[model samples]
Structure formats: C-alpha cells, structure tokens
Target: MKPRTSMVILFLLPASLFYLALFLVPAAWAFYYSAFDWSGFSDTMTFVGAGNFIRLLTEDPVFWRSFGNTLKIIFVGGFFTFSLAFLLAVLLNSGIKGKKVFRALIFMPNVIATIALTTLWAFAIYSPRSGILPNFFKLIGWEAGTKFLWMSPEHVFWSMLIAIVWINVGYFVVLILAGMDGIPLEFYEAAQLGRLSIHYGVWKTPAHLPVGLRHCHWRDDAPADCCSQYRCAPPDEARIPAILGENP
Candidate 1:
C-alpha cells in the first residue's frame, strides 16, 4: 500500500474505534434488549420472540398517538422553522444595518439552558391564567384565561412546537447563514447577468439559475474547483469570532 494511504488510515482508525464503542455497541445492546422480556431493572429475563413488538403494534394507542404527533410536529413545525430561519438568514445577510446585533439577539435563546427555556415557556408564557400570552389575549378582548396550554391535549402539541422552534431556529439560522456566506459573489454576478425582462421597466431573474449553474460548474471541474469554489473558506476572518463572540 502507498505510504500516504497508510497515514490516512492511521489517522482515521481512532475515530472509527470511538464510533464503534460509543454508538454501534449501544445500538447492538438495544437490539438484544428488544428481543427480551426484561423489565429493565430485574434479574429474571425471558425471550419474548417479538411478542413485545406484536403487542405494541396491536395494543398501544398512546404509542400510535405519539408517533402521529411526532410526524405532525416534524412536518408542520419543521416547515415553519426552516422557512423563518431561511428568511431571517437572507435578510441578515443582505448587508442590513446592525445585522450583527440582530443576529446576536436572535441567537441569544440558544445560550439559555433548554430545561430553563422549557420551564419559562410552560410557566411564564403559556400559563393561561396570568401568563404573558393570556394577558395579551385579554387585552385583545378574548377569554384566554380559560385553558391550561400544556394540559390540554389539543393545544399541547402546538405549545411544544412553539417552544422547540423558538429554541432551534437560531442555531439553524446560523448554519444556513454560514452556508450562504460561503457562496462566492462571482456566482451572484453571473446570475444577475442572466436576468430577463418580464414587463415594461421591470426585470425578473430566475432565482434558481445561480444554484443550478453552481452545481453544473462544480460537476465540470470535479477535480479542481469542486472543493475550492463551492466549498471554499470565506475571505472574512471575523466570521467565527462574530458568531461565537470573543469570550471563547
């Protein structure tokens, strides 16, 4: 084998071992446990032979409800979170004044502990009787003090989605903005050149042209510009410091 290939293998060996130990081992153990009738804390163990899986499939209403709720949250909440984050990232990246301050303020929720944020959402924001949202609703002439937000099955999923989105959108915005920042200005210029006139004194550009062109360019130069232009580091050195702050 080549010496360079040997060195690459040597470097990756530790990470491969770590993944096996931390992830694969636990996954295998879980598979084994799933086949048994172990109460998770007892000594006696019985082989269930897929009996537990059959029971869950036929008998578990709450399990099915939870699964449905999870799918609803992923599709509905994910759409809202992704759309909002993308819009915010585009606006933030548009050379807006005080963009850094806005980004920091948006990202501030990420610094707060998850449990603390959940507690605040549950008690202070959604308490229904005297909470901030209830008070706001009362001011709008609606009877908001009648229901406990988290206790009601109908509203609990939405409340959870709101909390999750509030906590997560910031992190996703940062990621999407980082990706946007990496896109070269040359592509945007090329895209602008491809603009078409739609009506009188009005020009319209195909929004997807730049992304499509970028992929085509990368495919043509797979060995060279593939990992450089589309995947190059930004010229700005302050990006990391701006995102993480100077305390680190």
Candidate 2:
C-alpha cells in the first residue's frame, strides 16, 4: 500500500494486539466456559449447552434480588451525588467568604482510600453497639442501643446510602466545579444585564435578545455602549474577561 497507510498500520498494530490479547481472549474464553459443566479449576470439562443460563433464569431469586438491590443503590446514590455536587458547585462559584476552606474540606475525603473509608464507615460510624450514631442518640435523649440501627435490614440500606454519598460527593463536586469554571464570565454578566433591563422596562422582550447580545454586557463600558445598539456581537470579539479571584 501507500507509505502513509503503512505508517498508520504500524502505529496501530501494538494497540490492536494488546486489545485482542487482553479483552478479546478473555471474553471468548468466558463464552466457552458458559457452555460447560466444568468446575473452574477441574481437568475434565463437559459441554452443558444452556443449562447454566436456564437454571439462572428459572430458579435464581437470590441473584435477581441482589441485582435489583444493586440497581436501587445506583439510582439513589447517583441522585444524591449529582444533587449535592450541583449545590456544592454553585456554592463554590458564588463569591462567598472562606469558600476556599469549605471547598478543601469537601474535597479532602476523595484523597482517602475506598477500603479504608468503608472500614471506618462500618466500624466507627455504623457499629450499632458503640458507634458514633449511638452516642449521638444517647446525647439527644433517645435510647442508644443496637435495636435502633444496623440490626434491621431496612436500616442497613440507608446506612450504606449515607456512606456511599459521603465518599462520592467530593469527587463529583470537583467535576461540577470544573464545569462551572469553564463557563465564560461574560455569560453571567450578560444574564445580569438582561435582568436589569427587564427590571427597568427598557427591553420589552428580554427573552428574544440573541445569546451574543446577552454576552456582550461583560465588555468595558465604551465597547458595551457601542455594542448595545446591535442585537448581537461577533463571536471573535465576545470573549469573557479574566477571572478576578482565586478558585475555591
């Protein structure tokens, strides 16, 4: 073939080989294994057709229950994580006092190991007999005992949800904060000006203003006046101003 095609093939060959070896091989092996009656480490293997899948579908209530529980946890955990991250991002973006300290405090949990965090959560936070929750209950005039906590299956799920939320909130907060940081300041300034004009009744149809016009409000007073006559500014000239403060 041509020299360029040869060079492209050479560049991609190693990665393609690695993927075949690591992923394709294992997946093919699993498909083969699924049709067998082999004990995973046994020397003799027998083909069992679809026996395993048939049994799983017909008589596996426990497996199905566990799968359902996993889905529940994912939905609940994702909801809490996304909501808290959005709120945290908004708080960090606001020009509030001491926001840096709060952001650091929220993000500190992400640096910790998952196993270590789970261990601490199980022993220190949810240990029904002498855990922190029990102590707090006693201090608040409630009976501090095992009966009120982890002893119940219903309560255990809530306890797990709390731990999952605590561990993941920081990471999601950082992601959303980064997204917020990437939004141009001019968009916000334009939004503010749009609101002001609406309040003073100068612009009757604020919603009808082009997005470019809304963003032009961030320019210096001179440029802003010049640009105000037009509904929208050119994209090249409508850049955001430099951020004035340190990131929290």
Candidate 3:
C-alpha cells in the first residue's frame, strides 16, 4: 500500500524467488513422489493413493515406537538438560574460581561432532566387554555385581537419552549463562548480600535480587526456579521463557 513498502518488496522479490526455486520446488517434487511406489533410481512411478500413509498408520509399529522415543527424548531428556543447564548457569554466574575452565569443559563437547561423541560413548563407556563403567566398577571391587550391559538394545535407549542430554545441555548452559550475564551485576550482589532473617527463613533478599527470595505463604521448587518472575526488572516475569525465546 505504501510506496516504501512496495519498493522494499520489489527489492526482496528476486532473493525470495531464488529461495523458493532452490528449496520449495524440490520439496514439492518430493511430496509428489511420496504418494507413489517407485525405486528412487527408476523413472516409472505407480501411484498408490495414500497406501503408504495407510500402511504407516495401521501397520508400522517401528514408526510408532520411533515416534514415542522421540517424545520421550524431547520431554524426559529435555527436562534434565534444561534443568541442569539452568543450575550450571547459576553456578557459573556466581563468583567462582576456574570459571573459564569450567565453561570450556562444559561447552567443548558441543563443539565435537555427534558421531565422534557417539563413538567415544559406545566404545569407551558403554561397550559391554571392555567399557569404562564395567572396568571402573571392577576397580572399585563391585565388578561381579555391577556388570551392566550398557550397549544392549534394552539399555541403548537410555544411552541414547544420555547422549542426547550430554550433547545438548552444554549449548543451553552457555545460552542461559549469557542471559544471566545480561542481567545487571547489582542483582547478583543483592542476592549475595541477603541478610539472615526470620521472615523468610535463612536469608531474605531484596526485591531486586531474584535467586533466593520467595513470596510469603508460597514455598517450593516452583517458586525457586520461577524467581525471575518474582524479580523486579520487568515487574514479575520468568527469565527462562525469555532465555528460551518465548517472552523475548
């Protein structure tokens, strides 16, 4: 409607067209092929009319298992990853020694390739015969009782979940640390300066400090993690939603 907007669209149109041609055209072709029965190398495509979809829905236990596994990883593994990351972020943000070394130690795993990490975990830690866990248990005099088969199919899902958490937590830890760092240093100081009092128990932080303070009549794990909301910077708001890009 506006002249400047029209000119901006005109300027953006070429790149937009190029992107659509590069991405959407091939995606459309793939969608078309997905409905047919054809070897990828063959030219003839026998249209199956949702037959693949029907088979996948009604007969694919493997697919459903995979779907369930994905959900479990996303929720269960995600919970540990995010929770531990937040804890690590808080710990690292506090005045501590070897902060940089700790940060690097936590984050360097993320820089390594997933395949490389998998190889290390599989061979060095989870391998049934010569794995580190079994060997370590033996060294600790519990080999007979603790000969855990970590690489077995029954246990591999848990291994996968561990691997997923290990790979992911570092990145989010760094991210949350960055967000925590963005907050004014005064808040952290206030949290540390909280005086011991009977009102809120051990120590009562000022309104500006979020970490240790909780509303009266409400005390639990929920309030401790949700302290960013009980904070004063933006009135009452959770930093996690902001850290994860929900409130941002």
Per-residue lDDT of model 2, residues 4-82, tens digit only? 9999999999999999999999999999899999889999989999998898888999888888878877898889888
Report the CA-based lDDT of candidate 1 relative to the real structure.
0.71
lDDT, model 3, position 184: 74
lDDT of 3 by residue, 66-91 (tens): 99999999999999999989999889
State residue 200's C-alpha deviation in candidate 1, in Å.
Answer: 6.2
Best of the two (1, 2) by TM-score: 1
Give lDDT per model, in order.
0.71, 0.73, 0.74
Q: Which ten residues in a row have the lowest lDDT in candidate 3?
A: 212-221
Instruction: Provide the lDDT at 95 for model 2.
Output: 79
Off by over 4 Å in 3: 1-23, 144-146, 189-201, 204-248
What ranking of all candidate models by TM-score puts the best one first? 3, 1, 2
Pick the TM-score winner.
3
lDDT tens digits, residue span 47-100, model 1: 998988988889999889889989988898899889989999999998799987
**Worst 10-residue stretch by lDDT in candidate 2?**
237-246
